[model samples]
Target chain A: MTEAVDDATLVQMFETMALVAATDDALRAAISAGSATLAYYSPRGQEAVAAGFAAALRPDDYLVTTYRGLHDQIAKGVPLRPLLAEMLGKAEGTGRGKGGPMHVSWPDVGLMLTTGVVGSGLPIAAGLAWAAARQGEGRVTVASFGDGATNIGAFHEAANLAAVWGLPVIFLCQNNGYGEHTAFADHLRVDHVAQRAAAYGMPGVTVDGNDPVAVHDAVSVAVARARAGEGPTLVEAVTYRLFGHVFGDRMTYVDPKELEAAWKREPVTRFRQTLVEWGLLSEADAAAIEERSATTAAATLAEVLELPEPGADEVLTDVVAPAGADATKRTARAATKVVVPDGSVEVSVRSAITLALDEALESDGRVVLLGEDISDSGVFGVTKGLAAKHGADRVRDTPISEQAIVGAAVGAALGGLRPVAEVMFMDFLGLCLDQLANHAAKLRYMSGGLTPVPMVLRTAVGGGLQVGAQHSQMLEAWLTHVPGLKVVVPSTPSDARGLMAACIADEDPCVFIEQVLLLSRKGVIDSTPIELGVADIKRPGADVTVVTYGRQVHQALAVADALTSKGVEVEVLDLRSLVPLDEAAVLESVGRTRRAVILHEAVVTGGFGAELAAGISEALFGRLVAPVLRVGALPAPLPYARGLERLALPGPERLLEALEWVMAYEG
Target chain B: MLLRLPKIGMEMTEAVLAGWLVDDGATVVKGQALYEMETDKVTNEIESPAAGRLRRIAQEGMTYQVGDPLAEIDED
Candidate 1:
């Protein structure tokens, strides 16, 4: 063990400790001076833990940390100027003033992420390690989370996935005695957090975090094991936090005696004494090292304060993947030649979905799928026979952990694989929306366009199944509301096969919502791809324009058929892609018909239909033959009773009633 | 031979005889749609079993439990 810890290595650790302690001092000074107002998390007492681990990590290795990770970020080689600039909301910041101190990321230096959410970085670290293993590069990844994060599902899921896949990663838990205001003993059930690692079939160790030498040796051994491809190890470093959770937080929650004892073993002072006792460095030399770090920090802060703020044009720069990617993506797709089966014949939406998955699997070696029962043919049978055809490695079955399923997809996509993950039902989205909304939707924009998530989250949605509130509901509006997400809801079997091809090939992350009732209806399809965001006029007429999507498109078509003989001509417009919505097609139809009716399966209060209705009212003012009408689900939750379910869903009968109301109307 | 109502769902113990496309003693072909049956949430068309004369044993709008005979088709 001493072999991993030589005098040179200890010196490097000592230098890192001084630097981190100095950076902390500068940050507190800036906060006190009113130059920086962001709530800071001072890792003042835990500097040695980061210092030792940073010394053990190689230059090319990856590390993901938390909001309270300024010490680790500096140790991993990120320049303090950019990091501090970000905190000061300056244009020269790490994320150009968008990411502040809590989310500073410098991937070029192997500091991949510093997420604000607790415990969410574990799965991403697993993905990085897996990518390195796949490339045959002998690199390892370290994921650092707080002790409170150990109780989160992402921590458990990532640990199990890394062990099962034999990924080269290390799970580092910084047990700083307190998580926010709650003490470790009061929050955790186990005696030590490392004891939780045995359940995932990995080695766990507890180390004295204050001792820089001991922490360095333990991390060096773990890194060596991971580089040797022996898989991940969990290392719990026990330390204390001198400051409260946030900068302005008061100390009323902590016991003064505990705080006093922790201060006695402060890492910088303890390590400096060790260095002097070993005769490796004099007291004056240590004081000189501290002075150098303080001077560098002060100079960097002065430079950061002079940088300019971002201008108004920054409002819409990095929200989605950049333009011109579509052309390149389409050109690449042409090389795929994904042969849709029996192009001459028609099939059901369920069969179309299977064909799409099969095509994507055959065309690209980078595409993979993972879900709860997908390897077992899936509950909806959308992935039926895919495991047999593509093998279990590409079509994997996961434990019933939604956060992990989505988190791994985001990470794997960043790691160079296009994952098509399934959540079985839309209601289950509640379990993993944080992964979708926070990570997948915002990664590209927040990373300053450096990272683009090219993954697809496929889930079945509808209310006619009688599966009760947990399994039945239309929640597509929730996804469409997010800025960086691509929302795809196909109405026909052909669109199911075609739009999925386009969505899977696109560079941005997408939410593919499959309507369950439409799965059994047969429609025409071919290998010719359908363009995304291009609305289709399913049925054309002149008197009224009926705008809808997904299952409601079928109702609109049926309404057109029933009203043809009643002297009323109707037009049906299906908006396939909701995010990049085709407003021109909607306006053209409304202008021709002079009347509009918006329909959807979600509740009317804040549905996608309302967005269309409001947009139409503004764009086509004074051109309407009558007021625009909206027919949607009732405001209440969908019940299990058949009668209530039928009433709750607006179907063909409801569409006919709406048509009558629009026809017998006055402008 | 008698034609019995088939079970379609996990919790289904009975079905409604919604309507019939064929009349009593009507000669129908095998696998032809003979009637429509309604479960609690869905309505499905029940197909014929044999190419023969269909004898109606149950009236429309009436409830029929599982294993109950709906009609008998006499073979040629």
Candidate 2:
């Protein structure tokens, strides 16, 4: 522990520790009193780590921490009252109570993100540091996570990438000696988490987390290195969790002797004794702060619990950008009325993405291209020539970590840069879904529109060419299901360019799904811009309406062409945009055609087509000529054989059969 | 010699003569654009194979199949 610290800073650190310990006590009391029922991750013994680490950071510096981040938030200068209100689920809370305790984000104080998912904060910290570097600001980002996080892929990616990119970030590992009651020694093989930092070519330091001054001194070194553009530093604050991981955990698995020893050396009381011995803080002075902090924390918790819950109207307000003048303004900025290329300038989907990404990169200074293989022109040639054209800084190639690729994008977007992160394939989304579903999808609503996550996650979707089960899954339904996300799937090249431009201009998070089959399929792209949430009529007719998107759009068109010879006029509506669903276009087409057929390449059980079918049926329940017919792949993992794959996905033959079924239905 | 549109894709048997890039009877060099063709797969420029005075053999905006000559190039 560093004994050379000044009295004023020591006094400040003592106060921070007292406040956090008081908050922990109040939360336990609230749970006991039945005033609050939310699962709380107590940071009782870990208060010294936050107090010490935060002492060296300025208000403009960023922080990404885990759910056990109340102390970190308090140390970063988040007001105790609003934070307590949030933990109590008050509308006046930091996240307006939408985020609860686990997902608090106070960008105003540089407490950028808090997530419930383990090991996810490191990548997000990397992104904030990257954004700071891009802005030419000397702001350093502190990423605090558990010792268990060191074993995760995101930690490795963040440590390596931040070092390689020279991002100003300090990777803070708060070693609490347990990952949800399992001892650190059992979960991790290394003696100390800091030792792993050497592999990433960064300085590693381990400090006594029980001592506030020691933590502050250690973090100060990292903070200085980062501000000097010396890249990232890894700091492991070895501490113990005196309480259970969550409010109600029985904690029966821990060694009772170790627990007794840790409790005897608890940070708050021990720090007070140290201050008294140094003659800097009198025993009376430390007692008064502890006494006052306890009263405030408990009283605020009780008061905020009585506060009114969020109103029902609050549900729809922050799903996307706020409606009203801003919606109109954003729509004007994003929409470019649909225009076609003058001549048949054929373009494949891959080349179209390359051109669109290039245009997006050229037009906006804030726009950044991030993902794996993007610098290598992408796996399918989608980003060919982009890294060279835009320069390496703008078109960044990241390590093979989906969590970092996505989590960092969310951070970068919140930090003022428009980052477009790619996860290579749709299946890879599983590895990084916490950032996408929990962070990016909820930040706008959670922050009560205070922060806009204006970033795009471009991933390849659908199955074909014999790429088996894991590689060949169409998961647009999962993304479209997330309320805060805008899902876009462009079947044709023109739509790919225009819709991509609109998505980039949109002031919300978007998941842009590109098809593998459409990469080679050539088509004419008009120079005219297309707006989002607008569907295009690929084949106009007055018979059955076939609704589809992405790869299946072409099959619907082929079916319509084949039916043309039989004098059966079938209309195909390519639902290019999924989330801001062009319900009007779908209804208008179906209203004219009278019969509806919804189709997709995903399995029928939980596919996006099911939602479209239900919605179309409800809108035109009595006015329809027949029930909405849905044609999709069977319920099974996509197999490897050509015959099995064909049978698994909806194709021209399947569409033709479904068309005949819908056309013949009299009800 | 007839300057014909080449096959761009296996599925394409015919294509629309989108427009002519050069005037009729104009002297053209090899690789110079004579006209453009829009097939089901992609849009491509039909370049002159030989340097010659070009003569229009087919009208613009007409549907022509593979091996169907669109212009006659007279070597000068």
Q: What are the clash counts of all predictions, listed in order?
A: 0, 3
Best by TM-score: 1
Question: Model 2, A24-65: lDDT tens per residue?
Answer: 877764443223556678898999999999988889999888
Task: Mark the regions of model 2 whose C-alpha exceeds 4 Å error after superposition.
Answer: A1-4, A324-344, B1-76
Q: In candidate 1, which residue pairs get closer than 3 Å at backbone N, Cα or C atoms, i.e. clash?
A: none
In order, candidate lDDTs are 0.83, 0.83
What tens-digit string does per-residue lDDT give for candidate 1 at A121-202?
8887887777677667788889998899998888998999889878899898889988778889889989999999999999
Estimate the lDDT of model 2: 0.83
How many angstroms is residue A650 displaced in model 1 relative to the true structure, after the best TM-score fit?
A: 0.8
